[model samples]
Target: MRELIKEAIVDLKRNDGFIYVTAEGKKIDLHEAAARGIAVTPVNPKDQVIKKLESAGLHLTDNKFVADLNELISVLNGGGSSKSAGKRRSFSDDEKSKILEEWQKVEAAGKKTKAAFAREIGVGYQTFINWLRG
Candidate 1:
């Protein structure tokens, strides 16, 4: 597991990352990072909060440290989306492709069938079909 982490850190393709530096000043290792639930996340580092921290000479140790501060801010603002919060649900890549394919087939038919689309989702099949038309 430790070896895998070192490989990941060595093979890191971006400057962005979550790193783990041993308290003993040893080389930052990836296994410790994985244990800490690390990943390469994208966000503006020099945003307002980052700027404030940097300006105050409060140096951050790693991405987790920065994310922890972001989470605190989201909680203060009525529990909004934080660094740890999962993003909203939406169609997956496959689902998006399926939707486009279905749409094309329907358009080519020239006569759309008001059938049960959301049958698997909605409570009653008929009700869901009615919704699709509207």
Candidate 2:
């Protein structure tokens, strides 16, 4: 893993427009790195909050962090029933390609059915069809 990280850093350096090391220290342009697929990630507020808490000698597992947040909500609501949170899912380009490949395999079989393909890929039938259209 260390060697892979080192290789990635070297590759990033080769793409001179994105990364730079100044007289003071190293600097990285996140936008440029993301555009080049070198370091693509969503901005996670939970991670930022965890970092702040860690400095104060507080450590939290992901589940514990979520439970604490839920408890805070319960307190704010004066012990009212808390609503369950629902998260929207997203897929990366690689994952989309893999799904498409799976769909193609299903199509190559004797029976070609979108619903079956969607079910196998853990997506709604309509959504799978839309992906194929795209």
Candidate 3:
């Protein structure tokens, strides 16, 4: 196995509330990168809470960082569910056929790209592509 590197640099200029840094051309959360054995630089001296949490092997989710740990744990464990959480919107076969038929009219009009058409109709771009494939 390849030895994991233990150090990474934070682009302080790119700081956008969440601690994120570039690794191998992709932007990743600093805490997540740290879990993969990468250490981030310029740790804030006054941020003892983060340090304590890290030391305890606890990482906060982007949505609920300021929430109580127990609440966060409950959310993570699926006890406290959000409306959109883990649910995929599925289209019925008749809905799919109607959507594809509408797409044909849109395509014949030649005014929008596939992605733009998907957005205009409120369907996900990937989902629209899948409909086309069928």
Candidate 4:
């Protein structure tokens, strides 16, 4: 049964969805496998880490484990605090004016729309629009 579960997990990972065939050539979906007590679930990295820790006899409620888990979760969630996540880049008025001026030249060339020009220059379309408004 454990081997069957592992085989199912491998099959699911190899494919986009869960599909398995038994030794007797019986095709089964994930729900059917679950009903038969195969117990297949989607692979989650966080859950896998926790399971590994538990299997290694580490208590999830321990202070050190909890702290480490929190840190790991933060990193998985795109870094922890706002400071570590970094700040939004600030552009000076002069820089904005220069970019807008360049945009005007591109606009005159008629090769690209404002949004396309903004993308080509690596600026957000809405940010470029805001610069134009100013």
Name the candidate that leads on lDDT.
Answer: 4
Question: Which model is ahead, 1 or 4, in terms of lDDT?
Answer: 4
Residue 114 in model 4: shift from native, Å? 1.1
Off by over 4 Å in 2: 1-86
Predicted candidate 2 versus true structure: per-residue lDDT over 33-76, tens digit per residue: 55655633332334444554556544555677668777777978
- Mind sharing the TM-score for model 4? 0.35
TM value for model 3: 0.36
Candidate 4, pairs of clashing residues:
none
lDDT order, best first, reads 4, 3, 2, 1
Give each model a TM-score.
0.20, 0.37, 0.36, 0.35
Model 4, range 1-134, lDDT digits (tens) per residue?
45544643565465544345455545556667778876444544334445545666655758887776677788799776543355555788888889888888888889899888888877788998988888
What tens-digit string does per-residue lDDT give for candidate 1 at 1-134? 45544544453533654334454433344665567755433333234234445556544546776677777777888887644456533555676466546645765786554343343332244543443453
* C-alpha RMSD (angstroms) for model 3: 16.5
lDDT of 3 by residue, 27-89 (tens): 466777778986554334224334444555545433454355666567788795464467676
Backbone N/Cα/C clashes per model: 0, 0, 0, 0
Question: Which pairs clash in model 1?
Answer: none
* List of clashing residue pairs for candidate 2: none
Q: Per-model C-alpha lDDT, please?
A: 0.49, 0.61, 0.62, 0.67
Model 3's alpha-carbon lDDT is 0.62
Candidate 4 Cα errors over 4 Å, as ranges: 1-87
